[model samples]
Target: MIIIQLNQRQQKIIEIVKENQPITSENIASMLNVTRATLRSDLAILTMTGILDARPKVGYFYTGVNQINLLGNDIKEKKVEDMMGMPVVVKKDVSLYDVIVEMFLSDVGSIFIIDDQENLCGVVSRKDLLKATIGGLDINKMPIGMIMTRTPNVVTVKREDSIVLAARKIIEHEIDSIPVVDMDDEHNVTKVIGRISKTNITKLFLEIAGE
Candidate 1:
């Protein structure tokens, strides 16, 4: 069987259908506090994915089993590189002011810091810049490297690592983004190749659900 992962809203829809089989789309929308039109796309996706079966004059019915377990296994087996976004990077010697500007221009929550040779050195987040501002430090004169979360302390993931592991690192460390790194034979970070964020994970879930 081809197992497809469902998002939270999709799972909720399945639950409602299971409990109240043959329920009309109008009633389902009312129960979920959404417009029937709003649910049209979701319904279409579920039906097309074979997760739900809709009958004329009847309602929606659940047709799959062990969906949650299968989804969990699928996520565990997925690789980080497949879902990672391009990394936004800055030189370690970049001015603190410039770093903040780069973060805004790139529209990323975090930025990777690299050295003259383009080696991974550190990472800076919006929170870090905020703290620096609140501290009344000179943003223009200070180099971002001085305030960045340095290597050995930065939480990173290998491109080939499981996405599940990367997700755990995000949750455990309370970070918004993680740098996907390539390492040398000795396991030292050699390059900042990509990034994985909560948004990336959400997009992956949506894609799996055929949305």
Candidate 2:
């Protein structure tokens, strides 16, 4: 059982809402001597945590004490596809210099490497590029494939997988992002459809927390 500790403000908000059942955000704001906008974030967090439930044209009501447990289960059940973003990809034969430019232009920490058939082949991260450049390799002549972490080594997740599994892979591999791949009949990677990064996971959590 996981216990989510509430902040002082959140605790206070819960107290106020419990004391005044079905209270409006505006009224709660007045009681706290703060504007409704100011309390919006706190309200969101409370609602997301299940500590407070909002009704249309009504007000907020206390749900129950086990809200955090329910929220935790909800997060665990969320699919990776729901949170994946479009991948930043590069051709295997593209020059390292071009790869660098694309990476910077896309503002991504890593890039997926693909073959002419668009099959997932490899992945290149910022560290991989930095190491290659620092080794005095001719960036203009070296193809990105030469420096990429190739297939059979690349960690990948599928669309149907859970976001929790994606997060675990990210942490265990110590990588900034993982490619979300589509599979062929033989279970080989067929295409790079999307990517899951630490930022994506963080944003998902914040979005759920009503941030």
Candidate 3:
């Protein structure tokens, strides 16, 4: 169930091709007052989605398939690795103040802590920091390791995991984000590479809604 809410140009392209079957891309571009390069991606998307049929040396033909916006299949196929953002990682030995500073600078709700081997060892969230602050802990003197939620207690997602799986973990753990990790089977450790958060999933939902 792939959803394709056609934009104005795409719909217009469909109409143009519908009116003039077997029309060349060059003529379509001239009709739309845009360059062939500008319509290249749109044409490609249309053809791939079965909205338009293209023939080499010929032109485009309307397939009589209107835009469909069901989003299930595409969403289900999305993986965490491709969608995850660069993670904000700091050494476990770093001061709590340094971690806080980095978190603010990066504008992330959570920060991943790495060990000397650069493997993920712990995670800290804004609520965790706040709790530490409330406990009268001195951020300047405290090591991030002391406050982090250490693994294997920390929740994580593999690069091959589906976005749906990642979203489920976030909801279950009630955390803002989860690290995208690669497991070292021989060493029994995981290395953090990326992160997925509510914001990312929200954007995906918005796209699905065609809003």
Q: Backbone clashes in each candidate structure, one number apiece?
A: 0, 0, 0
Point out where model 2 deviates above 4 Å.
1-71, 187-189
lDDT of 1 at 60: 91
**lDDT tens string, model 2, 7-95?**
88778888988999899999898998999998988999889767799998899998876753564567788898988999999899999
Q: Between the candidate structures 2 and 3, which one is better when assessed by lDDT?
A: 3
Please, what is the whole-model Cα lDDT of each candidate in the order they appear?
A: 0.89, 0.90, 0.91
lDDT of 3 at 55: 92
Q: How big is the RMSD of model 1? A: 10.0
User: For candidate 3, what is the TM-score?
Assistant: 0.67
Query: Could you give the C-alpha RMSD of every candidate to the true structure, in order shown?
Result: 10.0, 9.9, 9.8
What are the models' TM-scores?
0.66, 0.67, 0.67
**Sorted by TM-score, highest first, which candidate order results?**
3, 2, 1
Over 4 Å off, model 1: 1-73, 185-189
Q: Which lDDT tens digits does candidate 1 get at residues 1-211?
A: 3664567888789889989998999999999999999899889978876678999898898886544543445667899988999999999999999999999999999999999878898999999999998899999999999999998899999999998899899999999999999889576537999999999988877987779
lDDT of 3 by residue, 1-211 (tens): 6445679999899999999999999999999999999999999988988889999999899988645442456678799987899999999999988998998999999999999989999999999998998899999999999989999899999999999999999999999999999998899778898999999999988976778
